[model samples]
Target: MKMAPKGNDVIVSDRKLEMILSMKGGNGEASYANNSQAQAIHAQSMLHLLRETLDNIQLMEPPSETIPFALADLGCSCGNNTLYIVDVIIKHISKRYEASGYEPPEFSAFFSDLPSNDFNTLFQLLPPIGSSMEECLASDTHRSYFAAGVPGSFYRRLFPTRSIDFFHSAFSLHWLSQVPESALDKRSMAYNKGKVYIHGANEHTANAYKKQFQTDLAAFLGARSKEMKRCGSMFLVCLGRTSADPTDQGGPGILFGTHFQDAWNDLVQEGLITGEKRDSFNIPVYASSLQEFKEVVEANGSFVINKLEVFKGGSPLVVKQPDDAAEVGQALANSCRSVAGVLVDAHIGDQLSEELFKRVERRGSCYAKELIEQLQFFHIVASLSFA
Candidate 1:
């Protein structure tokens, strides 16, 4: 990344960020396909909200049965959860329209993400276990919906004006389009010298992260505003914070990245990788507060928040006994890797990245009690639409 002047602020291109930023693909044990239960759990817990949006949504004019109701799941990575949520939304919309004495509309659902996403696996999962892929997906006449993948960053426009009827995203917007160039510039005040993230970094460093999130989120809303229909509803779920302090990491406020930080330090001490490698590494994600989210939405002057709620990150672990620490640790490691392993791999090579997660798994097992009992995240779930 090079420092280019953007009217005084140093910036770099997002080409590298888009290329390297993707969850582990395929159905391998560590792949996001298998390890995305944490996301699924939170999203499933809020299925009612989807129904609520369907119930209360007031489209400018109901889409005719011939005009498919288009819904796009932004930042939808590869996994069953993507389809599961899309399926529920479609069913609910059909039921709602039917109950209102209107014909159930055909649906067009889009699964959107970066170009590197495992779209093959996602598309293959469309056909049921016994049904032949060709038979299930061959004709739109046999089904009530059509499924397609849109590959791109949501920070930019990906759809036509007033094309999308609804928008849904979960556990994805925390990622900034690019890591703030200042965070990696050794000469910048915001450079995170010894840390991989801003969880415990200084005020300048933390402010840089906050500014990046603010900018990215504003871009997200701006793009969505143009694509979404006038009265179309949008449901979003993203990692958030309720704490007053921006740098709060007390009681697992945020502890996942520390494993890489610790292991990278060891690698540096043992002469495996240079300190510069670890120093230059920073995760391009942030958990904004509900206040910050509202501020951005209000500032954008497009969408009006209908429903907003904060959910405690419930443990996805199913430990039957206290001795099931190994199981607990394994779950934690998989969840971390599913969402965040890409950051480590991008900074250090794949080999070192594997070694780092292995170390994280080992440490997680030893500290299973702490991880399970103390690990908590605040998630913000909101339903919004054009005012």
Candidate 2:
């Protein structure tokens, strides 16, 4: 893999970043739109939690009558998922102003992602302002909603200071700004061997992954702190592990890691990919524990935790049992391929992705019966207010 310098000293390669940004877009079979049902469900579950915060923002008196409610969704991928979130916010804010007998402020919602995201596809899917609402509030009728796509990585500043009133991110922050340098360095103690991530790795390798997550998360919080108005709130939902030990084989990372390792081993036996290539490749994801998440937020000191909760195994958001093994496997395969296909393709070459996913789908089918009973995944939903 080629390594290129980028960001604030983060050693991400230009090709890797480009592959991640540009590969998943549009509404094609491989697009995130078709594969992100679980993510959409998680985003829906957060709507109730966000209601109070949206109301509180409406209660605040704006410095001027014309300043619109500036809202943003970081890592807004191409789909109706983001539009669904925006609609929820618009509904709550409009109702609050109507109940208070005040004219509602206009909305300016920014959808942000890496530069290669399919903004064209996103705009085409978005319903015109009030079109999707069941009953448009009187305030909504008078006020217009302006939407724009702001292309950039959220690991750095993407907006002017104090410009945003509210922000959201879903299923995106778990990815580090870049892979840990030590993991890729042959001389380093953290050099991961024969596995893509820290799963089944030594203490040194695990800690290296943790350190990178901390650095990236801190940068994320710091940038948002500068961009948001005082008292502004952000709701973030991302993959998390129940275990404090990074090496524990208990989370979705382990599940995916096991499957990928098994698949690669089969491919190697068939002489499809070299052993060195398998050893060098690692997925740039870390499912942080609740404690780890709290530590990062507290250390940053820019936001106060309003609500911090974890939905563990068997949670509605994590487990959705399907009717049959084939259906279950196909759904899981679609979701995994949509997000991870780019990385896998980049590592081994795009020629093998279809065959790789086919093997993955077969393995996934065997687990359908088990998944029907329970799922081992968890999610951390955090609601924070600027301090």
Candidate 3:
């Protein structure tokens, strides 16, 4: 039972400062696009849950004239995944219109992410206006499709009041707006020493993470509340823990953190990075339990959960037939590096990330075979309607 942080000595920021928490952009070797197969799988799973909610929107009485339907994908990184999601949504909506004998409303899609995200790459990958529609909707319906990038943190309001009709986000909300202040404050009991995240950390460290998540999640819901129209629905999919216990270490959180720790430890041993640097660093990610997610949504009193589920995620690192440890290890390392390289580089210097991940690949090779066996990775999908 670790003691909680004393008083309010932790320096909490009033303003939600924009920081560089996005994945490596573009289609480069280390880019998120190349390493986001697992995320793409999660997105595909979420589409099944979104069909009903989207049908509900079409069920609403047809408005006078073709009112432009607005859809926003929050935390849309630079990749074809977001475009693929957008296409799916548009295709489903078109099908609903066709069934009801109603003309499909023109689409006004917004792809949003932190300012640092590669909008250039995203736009480049976006199918030409008529191309995507031709493949799904009938060519006769001259339903114009428009897309634009919204750059900023989703923890704050990004769209106008009551503008969004549908909102979707995948594999993003698990990230907190910022690292917990207590984890960085040396005087705080919640200081997370010698860990990049709250893996095997103390109870206080976990509490610190939980508190930050609650705040950020509230802010997220509040912002969306203002932007979403009445009866509008949001689909969110992200990593989550099954158990309420934060110290269980039975999930992806611990597995990934342990891999990073092992890599960092090797660096320390090699005199590449100092032990003190490793002690002070903590990744700004928290995987919440289903109960906690419900609590936050209910506490917000704005959105009602239409659907909530937890499902195991298939590991992208596994290979069929003869499994080569080296190949498997490198695949796992690349996946982790693509998403976390930015944060790791910021703290430990960009010069060492390549070498550090190489060590991680080598160290993680032995356990690569067991990656797919663990039932730790969970995909939490929730469909929420504005109440």
Candidate 4:
């Protein structure tokens, strides 16, 4: 058994980790593709905003078929969530074109994510483009559109300037390009000592995370602005801090046993890995507060905020039935694993990652009923357009 060693001076750099990080792929039980209902649900709630954007966006000079309507889903995880949004956009625009007594424009939809994302699965889930809405419904497929995969980071430009008529992302933009350098530097005072995330960490550690998020968001908005048409808009939803409180995870506070830190702490106590080694590893995600998010977008100055709201989001992993309480822990663990297992594996090894999550699952199951029944989180839903 290869236990991770703390003696190594250099860990895998954050840039390398970022390149390889992606949601668990494939259709297995643990795959992000299967476990991403929470994300899809988040998108569903933003349909009103999406519809509003579609109504306002003018893509073609006369809305002709020759000028295909172009839209891109940034950070499109390996799930049907992107497809769902793409379908909605296509349907909405097609209806408008038909009402104007014009031939409905051909649609171009791009699914984008990191190079390591489960894009193969995402592509497989796509239906034949240009199918009628009724045909799509009959086959349990999505709406009509030409589907293309754009493989790269969204932090940089992925489309030609002023080409995309609509941009959509959901539950994805909080990921930083890299974890803060200070958080991983043991010699630095801001080194995250005990926690795997900034949630409940010291002020220095929390600030480091917040700064990184702001930087990445600036780059993201900058890139999107170049690609968006003058009248185009973006609709986004992301998991975020519910309040001004730094430790806030939604409203109920973070679950004790189900968090990544609990599992890491258990491993450290068992001497499977040194505390120093644990300190070196941190998940590169931030749940930005709405105020913090708006500050960045405002600072960027490329886009004007159209709609922004924070609301409580429900989790399917919550324990609803008395008979099913036992499964809550496993569900919670699976949810976390699906989103981050790859990063964990890269930081530690596959074996250590498995054991760590096992401890989390076991502990979570034992404390299932004691945990919050709602497991609600706050989602920041926003719509923005070029300034």
| Per-model TM-score versus the true fold | 0.89, 0.88, 0.90, 0.91
Sorted by lDDT (best first), the order is: 4, 3, 1, 2
Report residue 121 deviation for candidate 2 (angstroms): 1.6
lDDT string, candidate 2, 67-175, tens digits:
8778999989888788878778877876777677676677799999888788898888765456422335443342247889998889999999999989989788887
Q: Which ranking of candidates, highest TM-score first?
A: 4, 3, 1, 2
Candidate 2: residue 56 Cα off by (Å): 4.0
**Number of the predicted model whose lDDT against the real structure is largest:** 4
Spell out the clash pairs found in candidate 4.
none
Q: RMSD in angstroms, candidate 4? A: 3.0
lDDT of 1 at 75: 85
User: TM-score: which candidate is best?
Assistant: 4
lDDT of 4 by residue, 94-167 (tens): 77776776667667889998999988999888876535654653454555677889989888889999899999
What lDDT does model 3 reach?
0.76
lDDT of 3 by residue, 1-387 (tens): 222232212222233335667788877767888878767776676666778777656345577336777999999998878887887788887777768787677789999999878789888876556755554465523334699999999999999998898999988888888889899788999988777778788999999888898898899999999999885888888778877787553555645677767888887788776777676667777888888888899999998888888867666553443267777677767777887887766555556778888877886677766654552478678889977
lDDT tens per residue, model 1, 159-222: 9999998999988888888778888899999888988777888788878888889899999999
Q: Per model, how many backbone clashes are there? A: 0, 2, 0, 0
Off by over 4 Å in 1: 1-14, 59-63, 128-143, 249-253, 316-322
Q: lDDT scores for all predictions?
A: 0.76, 0.74, 0.76, 0.77
| Candidate 1 minimal-lDDT segment of 10 residues | 5-14
